[model samples]
Target: MESPHAVLLVVLIATFAICNLVQAEDQEGFISLDCGLPPNEVSPYIEPITGLRFSSDSSFIQSGIIGKVDKSFETLKSYMTLRYFPDGKRNCYNLIVKQGTTYMIRATALYGNYDGHNNSPKFDLYIGANFWTTLDTGKSITGVGEEITYIPRSNSLDVCLVKTDTTTPFLSLLELRPLDKDTYLTTSGSLKNFRRYYLSNSESIIAYPEDVKDRIWESRFESEWKQISTTLKPNNSIGGYFVPQNALMTAAIPANESAPFSLTEELDSPTDELYVYLHFSEVQSLKANESREFDMLWGGEVVYDAFSPEYLNITTIQTNTPVTCKDGKCNLELRRTKNSTLPPLLNAIEFYTVIKFPQLETNETDVVAIKDIKATYELNRITWQGDPCVPQKFRWVGLDCNSLDTLTLPRITSLNLSSTGLKGNIAAGIQNLTHLEKLDLSNNNLTGGIPEFLANMKSLSFINLSKNNLNGSIPQALLKREKDGLKLSVDEKTRCFPGSCVTTTKKKFPVMIVALVSSAVVVIVVVLVLIFVFKKKKPSNLEALPPSSNTPCENVTSTSISDTSIETKRKRFSYSEVLEMTKNLQRPLGEGGFGVVYHGDINGSSQQVAVKLLSQSSTQGYKEFKAEVNSSSNFC
Candidate 1:
């Protein structure tokens, strides 16, 4: 018999243990990146959303390609600002994480028909250099997501998206949540990626401090079983497991002994071995003689036979035996054992498959350098994603790389920027590419004399600086290199002269003076001839002339009209002509304060004119009519 004091001490010790466990799990960090989120936005998740810190891609190079997703997917619409890689280049998101800690990373991509072309892309996902998963978003717009459990050897992890030929790559969401060390134990020193499905008779999503790891446990229910609801709420800790309380809070059991309760799930994994866990909790407190037993079967094979569950406490039974999947499908079931008094019940289930990753890619330093170079010069026309030199066929535009395989780091051997419209001084950052053998900056607007650093580049065997605007004497080191078999090309246009590099202006000064004098004399004679011709062509009745510079070509002046012969000058009428010309204002043109302007034919001629009927009530209209009459008197 246990003493009251000993029982109290045991409860206190258990309480302390649970507290410590909760604290450790809570200390884990959660980073959620909304990929294309608006820069500097600080929206925190709440309620239906997880309490995650949301961030944007402001730290990364601003990709010109961005798009919004449909509002129907509210969970993702908030993260619609997607950074798309139209150039089909590999883009990576570097996250600083705790070293030697396990983390669950999830990335989601949604086409949203964002480009309006409805072209879904296929790409490879990478963690550090290791291949993580393939992102093949077939034809669905629902968005594709891949989750992986990884332990970062370093303080950071690089989540990369590799573009393929089929479509452009893009990212919508990136979530990283640190997990408890003992959550998913494995023997191969490799972590197994688990997919959790929540089974319940209720409508609710369970996550976060309840799950501690914040895993999304999808809910499910059956019509045959009686739903047992528990008032027990999930606290921060659940014994030694970090699974959510909601996962183990609800259960469904059969009503009678004659009927058997079973849960069968078809896991969509063909040809691969699987690991499954069934979470159970006896929701009802049974009588002293009452016993509930069940048998769990993996494709008709009894893995756990005649297992009895304890009351009000969780008992998780996992399949130690790998279920061989046929045709990419494996079925698992939990049924009541024979002679058992109670029906079978389940709270949640977790499934996982082991994946064999391919060999990691080349060294990261060289890869990052090339990416920076492309970014610096805005060279986006070429799809430069993934390993630059691995696989050989696709190695960025105008760059020659030397590498043995995916295991070997590639070196940039040659660069061809000739006729690439590269302007200004040659980017000094090219110094980072120390392995270069040939450099061509020809036919560009590159200025500022040849950099002496080029001579220090011992690997360079050939260099072309032709047709550029470079000036000043070539560096002595470069000249020495030129003498020592270094192929150099600098045309006369780019090479500097012996003395100043600047042309002398003394010889051109006299020629310039003579040209100016000739120009001034020509201008004076032309102006006098124009004035004489204009005076002879002018008509005596000409009054006001429109300013030639300020007026449009359509605003013909009185002098230009009068310059015609007297016979060509038609008779002009005054204010009274408005009433006669418009035929009693029958033909409407447009409205104004001065009544309406009407399109009218001249009373005695075929000529047409626009006449305005001045409103009698408007003083401004009367003044405008008088001005129109005075203007008509000026015509020849």
Candidate 2:
């Protein structure tokens, strides 16, 4: 027979190996990002404590600077570094997830005085376009984390960090764990985690390898409570909640075995709604005549009239409807029933606050189209980090969305890429904007003929393709649309009708040669005339002429053209007038290489305007600025 100690060691080793195999197979849809970890650093490593794989966040976001935390808190690799956003008002991580799949999204932040400034920062966190919560990294090096159970409307989810105060917004870790679709269902909106704890006498935290879902359950024990635990593992094959057996193995009962087990929580506000989940198991063996029965109460109201924990089996109790503590306090008590001979006990508890997401995301097709366009052109606009529409104030620059109907998803109505330094052929993705009304591609280096898809877009009423090096025949469909009231603008010299394109180019070649020959003959005649005049007229006669008359004709013509240009120059607004128009530059539209654009209204009128404020540090010269202004004026 094997020794007892040796048998115990063999069992432990087998269990450890099994847990490792389970974790390796279960992480299919898990996404764990270690923010600010450099691309060249080691990544995709399994964290020993949680058994979850973590990778650098460089691929998920485009903005923010990386910094290492203070050396004192460098024990955990995930907490050693962070990503801090100091430029844009909002920076986001674009996470790709299965559409309609429920997920537990978690974001962690730690301020270990990374900037050498001891000040802790407070900022707002957002899920897609809706506000999730405000995170305050208080004066401790200990980190803070927020988790939410959500189902994204589309395949992509945006986790945004918004700068709400003077302090910068930073993130240490971001994780996504896919949950069963039927689990954690809410009537409407997402659920934000408030507290998740396992009743225990130990100080160690329990997560993955024990929980299977990688949920962090902190130990909680009150001096007034008596802890009861069993070495036997509880059967946790209940619902999809996945309450770990280790958590259910321990139970908390009142120190006085006959007293009711109770817990009280104070609500942040009277209107705050909450969902509570209670997990229980009979960890202690009972005598033949002993029985344990209880009635669960919330705020003095009985929720469950009679409840009993099956021996060594998981029993989960959750609120069917959201509960509100009107008086600002919630009291949960499990009172022993009249027939019960044992005390009421609890194994674990979880609390979540109901968070309503009323704002709808942008139309999926338009979002896909715009993001494709951004990729096609490699647009690096600072303000293009989140959703293209919804949350009206933060819409992407150069995009006008139609969100008049609250029930309908927002659609991109106008896109202004005028003088934005776009290159290559016109993007085909623009055709996906089904509701697009106006498009401005003027003053770009786009070199392709207009795509036929544009003619098929019935909603497109205006198109400006001027000042490009395009040489092609206009499609008949487009010409028809133009005749039927489409406002089309193109460089007429470079384009022609279907049959006339080749003939037109052929005619232009000879016409250009004839014009050059005529110019040469004119120059010869002028030279001969000047020589004859010089020979016939005396030097004194030439000197008698006015200085202005002696000037070359080319100089006079150039002067006349310059005067005409000055006369036709657009009106310029003063700094104070711009401020008044833009209401002190409060509504930002977007930022580009030139500067930031502000969405404003013309003073005393309902007309909307976009004011491009030049950055003081821009390296572009006056010529580019003038071209941008000219493009805008022509579009208007």
Candidate 3:
């Protein structure tokens, strides 16, 4: 039995746990990352202002140097630390989300002189492979935030920081918030947030629990405008936008009731297209006899005629088509109608610039196949961070993609993983790259029989599997394909019937013995020929003969002979001695027209050597053989 005080404590603890769980559930689709936060630090740090949880960005990105801002400028937890990329031209964060889901992505940067260099850095930002914008972190400790509302084409999203000049690229925070797909509609392109303002007299920035999406709504107040407020919460449940009720509680109206409420905005460029959203909620409770109605005009042209705001209910007006400002200026006015007796009021407003993404993403099948291959091989190449192709300049290494048609998605055509230290059988994912024309997996330790699927890849015309430990007969399908003009390269010695295949290590003994005996016989024959030639050309008066008149063999026997002495004195080894030198022909470096070359060490020393054994079917006769021996001897 528990005491009353203990029972009460248990209940309180359970209640607190439930509250925390509920808060976490509210952020189901939200992803908040605190860049450069130490991996060992406590994650899911609940930000005090927004009550949103933030985790370390170590899992999102692979390249970056963790840095800390000057302590004096550390205002928030997210601002204290940052990830800076000084190595690569582009560093990206890979995020996974539901395909086709609408999302609001926000990235923040603050240059707090982390490197002790008071100079700030300027760099470019990219969403996937398309350029988003250029960010300039000013000299001050103040932070800059950029936001975009987008619908991801696939389940993956890449937010990249690209270095444009000599300055390094860094990021302080990255956040993703899922939104209702119908909320931010556009005719063609994504929406980049320009401004989101709530008409209010307060100086506080509103976000989070107040605005469920955690969109930062800054307060905007004009001295000449009359402020209207109500304690009653506006009805926001009717619309998908869900404009914060607190934001809708306050309204701004013209000081002079008869004059129209007007505002003007400056565009970034003359050709900039814009989308405007205006939120209105009547803060005043009027009698049935009185009404508030206004005509909304854009650049002196009526856009919405005689619109009336329902008292205490949020009404949002959005542009159906993109509005282009003239001379880089846009103007809007809300005027009272003849039937209305009140001044026009505005509660909140949002401005967005339409950003068209011209570059198409890689084909879904290719992307999936490449991603699977990367995972299977556990490749960690830095350049493989984002889309394999697109943006042209940052294409993945060893990959050739076909992106000639701008309207169609890019497809992978070639993959070269030669000498990349790959193991195991060829990746099954490679067959899915239907457009791949060539694949080079040579100079690796890969084993197992060649996959028959390679033959099904109709586009494949070149394949290299040389210098590997593979065994078993080549797939008949692949052999047929090879006969059909496919350029295939494989070690013929390693090929055997399927069931008769043996490990290379077991088969190497017989080959090594044969190579050893053949090499010794060649050396003895060369030596015998040199001795016989010297006997046949025996010079009777050796002391009286001129230096140039002496036979080549006479120069070899002389100790004073500089170049030839080293070659003539080169030690000869027996078959067993050669085996000991080459580790019984264990490791093959590569093959050549003459024979196979085996890697060897000299006299148990670190000095490396390449031991070439002449093939039985080599076309070279005695002259070529002698020339080869002389050349090798000269090299030694």
Candidate 4:
């Protein structure tokens, strides 16, 4: 047997090694993000003063807005906002994370009536296309947030803002903090829900250097509770428990020593079951027999009857409390013991509701097929990175996936490759997308017999292969399917006859030259004859019309000419008349990326006209306008 001194030395060395290893891992895996912090800018991969890299939502979402919150409140004046997603789909913020590591992710939504509409918005939050929670800023203009602990299966995590019908979804803040291994364990491999409150009577919103983890510790409202501060502060960390490092730096004691301090929260529904945690630490040491004791009551039930206070050491009590929000309220109270001299005090409190997270994984077969197709055509128009269909918010560009509620695996429903400049045979990998409903391969250089395997795709309802150089007869299966409601568009000029693949033949050059010469001789003879007739009927005595015409023609002055055909009826309007009809070009309907579009009402008709004023500096605007005019004339 080893000596006691040797054993003690060995144990000490082992403990020191373990601590060093843990510290190294924490530094390597920890990540933090402060979303929408600096205003009036779009940043991608910007490292702020906090040393954590974050990106704005502008790069991921195309349409929406970003701005600062109302500055009337001092605590939240520095925060920013991202809102107004009219499309009901999800807009995601992709964060790079280590695979198979547990992370605590939190999102804060502070409406503060940012739009000045004085209305709060409610919407669902998502994690990599899976439903996480619903953020409802019910009545409080302060802030509302949700926190969850999850282990990401992939290297990237997609946090999405999902819009609802009644209101647009938005996000104000987001933070991701990696946790120590074996900290929050789940037997069933599911996510844990947590709510953290920074209980302080002082008006300090603690974060960053104060909290270190960058967790938002909301300060208590002084009006709701009277303040009590301890002169002798306790150690910052709690023992053996996962309490925040700086949570106990400040503490609060109730004002009235005789009455219990209580807190009540309003839940969205009455069916919420929660797990509660209360953290406590003694600020001042008791002299001799001076003691402070308390009993905790949750919803009229006594949970802890004789809870004694401890100094320097931290104590945490946990309970599984199933609470139904009667009148949408759940109450908790902390009362002093009958024999105690001091009032009850609390450092922090948390409530976590139990929920099952969705298991989002892409279908394996669809993944293989889509990846192969991407490789075959070298389709680089859109970035084809990551999984093809797992996260609905970050699906492969130019593709649509089926929305499955109960089922997590997604199916490819549509493939739009129109005008993608793809030049090759229709890839056989497409056969693997069994659920494909529509396929567009128009306006490409694809030259080959139409693949017959397409007819086997039962759900295909639409196919476009026009403006291609394909020269094979249409497969009978496709033709038959077209008759049964599958809309098909194939160019007639390149289509060949069935059974022999007989292509249209071109005329010889000699025959074309002979026909061109004869046409030119006939055109010369007609021109000579017209000239001779014009000379014989020359009006030598005819006088030209007067340069100035005072005679009025229906009191209408032609000021502008329409760009339409000469034979078409043209109506002219003077500059003043145009201004009168447009109301001096005021009241714009909407503004696009290039110009502002105005709404105008014309006189003598019930029609409303839209006038778009192109920006003078727009170089491409003139080209687009001319092309549009030519196309319209040809169509008419």
| lDDT (Cα, tens digit) per residue for candidate 4, span 52-86 | 34545444433446655676743322244545555
RMSD of each: 21.8, 19.9, 13.5, 22.3
Candidate 1: global Cα-lDDT? 0.61
- lDDT for predicted candidate 2 compared with the true structure: 0.78
Question: 1-636, model 2: which lDDT tens digit per residue?
Answer: 111111121223333454554444478899999999999988887764346789999999999999888886634556778999999998989999999899999888888889999988999999998899888887334777788999999999999999999999999899999987767888877898877889998755666778777677777888779999999988997877888888998999989888889887776667889989999999988999999999999988899977889889998889888998858788888899999999899999988889998888899899999999999999988899888986787889899998865577899999999998999888999999999999999998988777888899999999999988776777889889999999999886655666766544665888998975774465345334433543465111011011122222211122221122212223334345555666766788888766567776653434466666545445764346546654444333
Residue-level error in angstroms, candidate 1, position 361: 2.5
Alpha-carbon shift of residue 438 in model 1 (angstroms): 8.3
Residues 242-329 of candidate 3 have per-residue lDDT tens digits of 8889899999999999999987878768889999999988899998899999999998999999999998998889998899888979
Residue lDDT tens for model 1, 203-291: 45555545667565556666666777677753325334556766766776765545656655444456666667677777677787767
**Which of the two, 1 or 2, has more TM-score?**
2
**What pairs collide in candidate 2?**
none
Better of 1 and 2 by lDDT: 2
What TM-score does model 3 achieve against the real structure?
0.76
* Model 1 lDDT, residue 502, Cα: 31
The residue-level lDDT of candidate 3 at 277 comes to: 96
TM-score of each: 0.54, 0.76, 0.76, 0.52
Q: Supply every candidate's count of residue pairs whose N, Cα or C atoms clash at under 3 angstroms.
A: 5, 0, 0, 0
> Candidate 3 at 3: error in angstroms?
59
Index of the highest-lDDT prediction: 3
